[model samples]
Target chain A: MSIDVLLQQIVNGLVVGSVYALVALGYTMVYGILQLINFAHGEIVMIGALAALFVTNALIAVGVPPALALVIAILAAMIICAIVGVSVERIAYRPLRTAPRLAPLITAIGVSIFLQQIAILVFGRNYFTFPEIIPKTPMQFGAVIVTPNEIVIFVTSLLLMAGLLFLVNKTKIGTAMRATAEDQKVAGLMGIDINKIIAFTFAIGSGLGAVAGVMVASNYGQAHYFMGFMLGLKAFTAAVMGGIGNLWGAMVGGLILGLVENVGLMFVRGDYKDIFAFVVLVLVLIFRPQGLIGEKVAERA
Target chain B: MSALLENKRNQIIAFVALGIFLLILPFLAGMIGQAWVRILNITLLYVMLALGLNVVVGVAGLLDLGYVAFYAVGAYTWALLASNHFDLSYPFWVLLPLGAFLAALAGLMLGAPVLKLRGDYLAIVTLGFGEIIRILMNNLDKVSLPGSDTVYNLTNGPRGVTGIDGLNFFGFKVRQGIEVFGHQVTGLQLYYFVFLAIAILSVWMVYNLQHSRLGRAWQALREDEIAAKAMGINVRNVKLAAFAFGALTGGLAGGLFAAMQGFVSPESFGLLESVMILAMVVLGGMGHIPGVILGAVLLAAMPEVIRYVADENVQQKVFGLVVIAPEVLRNLIFSLAMILIMLYRPRGLWPSPDRKADTGGSAK
Candidate 1:
């Protein structure tokens, strides 16, 4: 392919990769702590995106400035999604905490389907148009072109990722998160309030997921009830690719996954784009099941 | 009481009674009409798929999220070989075992590379494998010739292959709709009987499998792989056997489905179908035959059952226009049911017989 097309694909990949990175962070954080895949994390992103769409449209209808409306919508979506993440943890997942390892996994899939059904009921199974708040002006750099939305999405994702890194690395709660992850029983014995830390994990993870949701919705110009399934799946792949339990690995995995998915289309038909993620997934899993960044643990029996 | 219930004599009696009931199931469904017989056929197909998955997830402790890909493989093989897609014109009986063997081969191929992975890693890989098959199917409809311009439809893309030939049994064709007992026995009814036979055979085979030496090896691996290996079980071979057997069962059902419906499509073998089959095994209680059967029937038929009960005609206009659409409630209720069942009855609605064997097969 031409360098211009390749450069454009890279730009597009990074923009989309940032959103995937955000979603993968939720998966990475939760898996690191609970060793659960958190299948419902994808739905949180959908809920946030839809909720933001609803609030922003409503605000605009009420004559609020478009810029202010978008900001409030994002905030509202994060709060609402965080609450949802906690509730799902409490109601569906908590009961099966001590059950078989697969119990929570099944529960997560059930909740993912249940939340999708709920979204279909509330949102009427149609795509809601998310108006473009950012300008559509194309910025040219001598054969490499970009849009305002792309730049905004890339910058916004970086800021959010940076914020998450700070919260997980420098904060006291971050220490609790790390401690509880290493061994839950010991952390609880040390009076770490494991419940709060777990809940906090869900909250932050879901909030970050919401930001990704809004970014994707804005990028695509619309969002639907089932947008989370494929995206969530890819993000999970990214999380695994980068190393499931490692934070920084998630970011790298998402970018790599995104780049490969888009860039691979240059050689093959575009219709086979979805298959590339799975192909990469199986290859990575076979060669480096722990992912690129995962520290080696004793091989599972 | 324990002695009588556990006696071989009583078991024979129960088996006979079940056989007699299944023989009459079609006639009973006929009273409701042909539409219901069709649903019963589909439900039976699900039972076959679920049973195959039971051998893997239930008996062997491998969570396979892509089991339906085998079903797809079987269906497509039958359609391409027997349908208008290629006009090869093979009979249903000829294609049944062949399709199943092909699916088993696919299973072996998949299990060989990835069987070493455990738990979630295995799950993600299996899931990817499933999507890979589906996407490949979806994209193979248009294949451009190497270095040439002609594009041929291999899978027919999303349009799917059609006009699959129906089953013909010993000079009696199900599609011809034979007359029996002064009533027209439609093709659907014939399908019900044939599929019922296949279901019974699959059950018998799987039941035998669960009690055989290989089955014991599978169970040993399930309980503790390292320990099983220490006890001299070939872990890889046994796991691969479980996968192949599961695929074989799924493929048999898929080939039969192609003959019964006279059509084949990619949509039938989706991730949701895989999950629903897994749900049957999980909800019915893993490693238990009777429990798995219960799960297969309930989950497969739950939506239609809900639809039948909640149709607008049945409503008494109770809530002053707060009417709940059946489709919406069906999905919501199904999901809630999954969550609630796992929450309350993690052992499944009907647990296996072995767990109760300690107390003369009595409830613990």
Candidate 2:
């Protein structure tokens, strides 16, 4: 409604957009390499957030300092999720590599549902409050206000993206990943272990998703067993918007989606805010299926 | 005379026996428990839905993940016209055809958008469309009119529309039982017969459609879209037809569901329902009518069977301990079944005999 309100919404969007970007990376990387949607990636994020909550609560109760407990929880979550991401690929996806296109997709959906059920069994059906370890002190910047958590979420996401870019562009493993994405058979012919590279890609993407999960939980101040379902859909929408399989596109798509959704909610009821990303997704598919940064390639015959 | 003739005669006898058994099932199950009859009714509805989806996914290889949206359309159509919500009531014949037509239009709308997209992209877009429909249903309760201060309650919001009128034909209401040969029949039993007749009609129609020229076109498209286009098949029209026909069945089923329950809500047409219907078509043997029906019946009955066997009383008596919740177990099994079946039985449990040598109907 006002300048300050618009600025505040923009700030809110940036923080959440960073998280969406992180999750989008997971979807993008998987899509890039395997040509799979990785429908279960959102469940990995949920698992990360809940695992962090569990660890943090336990550590804090045992007289550990809140700051240290948060760090430990974040690391533990990343590792747990990396293992989960890799294992899901091995068990559910590997056998169906040569199967029909719809086979793996259906299996992915199954994996998603299975993970959610497992989460429900472990965490029960209630929402867990994320511990307020980080200080939420608001800082004034002219007409706009921002919180310390918002800055942390944004900075952490940027650094992770930079690190990932460096890995893909500079490191040998990153080169192998890119080659694999370019052509799996050629990469294998070049003596690159395709399976291992694919597993590594999943690990890296899921680890970053873990950080995003924590950021989301810390930002929202609560975590639920099935919170990732809608979040996953929205993040995947971001991946598509940015031109699925493109890392930079994922980052750009996530931020744009978040900004549009947050700013658009100002005029409409908040209850319908979730519809914005999907509406964007449909419009994008109809108008520009390849996405903003995606190169226009001929459709495979 | 010939071995083939003898086999045909035995098959005829077997089919007659099975048909008689299904006809008497409602009364027999009613004597045992009313709940079983309700489960069977719902299963039949699912069979119709699965068959409808089979036209799109199994036959045409479209892989629609939001097939439930059309079901919602059909259900809401019945709810609005047959319920007291708008102070209107339509006859069964009028509502069913109207609902089916509306759903077919929706299918066309959905089909048009994703005509260029393929595989997972189409799947995701359809899924988003389905979610959009559900969200609209959930939030369309108090919509404000443009350039005016009038607020209208269309769907009645999350609470949903209740008190829907049952199917009425020639002054005979399904909600009220009819007498036959001096025997008192229950309302549910009568509804069961109606649903059975409709489901049979659907199966018969779908079976005929599968062997028709249009059916062959759909199959060719499913196997290779590019090739199908090259072979003089109207790809766009065939795809749209598959969606429309599939949606027609889903809509008819949804309208019937509303009549049976006398209630309709956004919750009934969620993504899980769509996935479950897809699972039924895939698990049964995509493109095979008998297999699809079998998959639908098994899956629809699975949860009910779980609830029965895992009832706390049954669990305590049988196992002497309740280690896990029955609902959670049901969902776990449901999810696992999807993954495992896809992994091992990629062509489904009862794949088409002709498709045995081919890949899963996809040309790379």
**Cα-based TM-score, every candidate:** 0.95, 0.95
Which clashing pairs does model 2 show? none
DockQ-based CAPRI category assigned to the predicted complex of candidate 2:
medium
lDDT of 1 by residue, B1-364 (tens): 5687699999889879988998888778888987888899999999999999999988888888888999999998898898778768887668999999999999998898887677667777788888888888888888988899998888887788899888877667787788878988778888888888889888999999999999999988877777889999999999999999999998899899888888877888888888889889888888888889999999989988887876666654654453667677777788888889889976778877565321001111
Model 1 chain B — which ten-residue stretch has the worst lDDT? Answer: B355-364
Instruction: List runs of model 2 lying over 4 Å from the truth.
Output: B1-6, B181-183, B356-364
Candidate 2 total steric clashes? 0
Sliding window of 10 residues with minimal summed lDDT for model 2 chain B = B355-364
Candidate 1 CAPRI level: acceptable
lDDT by residue (tens digit), candidate 2, B36-114: 8888899999999999999999888887889999999999999999899998998988999999999999999988987
Report how closely model 2 matches the true complex, as a DockQ value: 0.54
User: Global CA lDDT of candidate 1, please?
Assistant: 0.86
Q: What is the lDDT of residue A63 in candidate 2?
A: 95
| Candidate 1 deviant stretches above 4 angstroms | A299-301, B1-4, B7-13, B320-322, B353-364
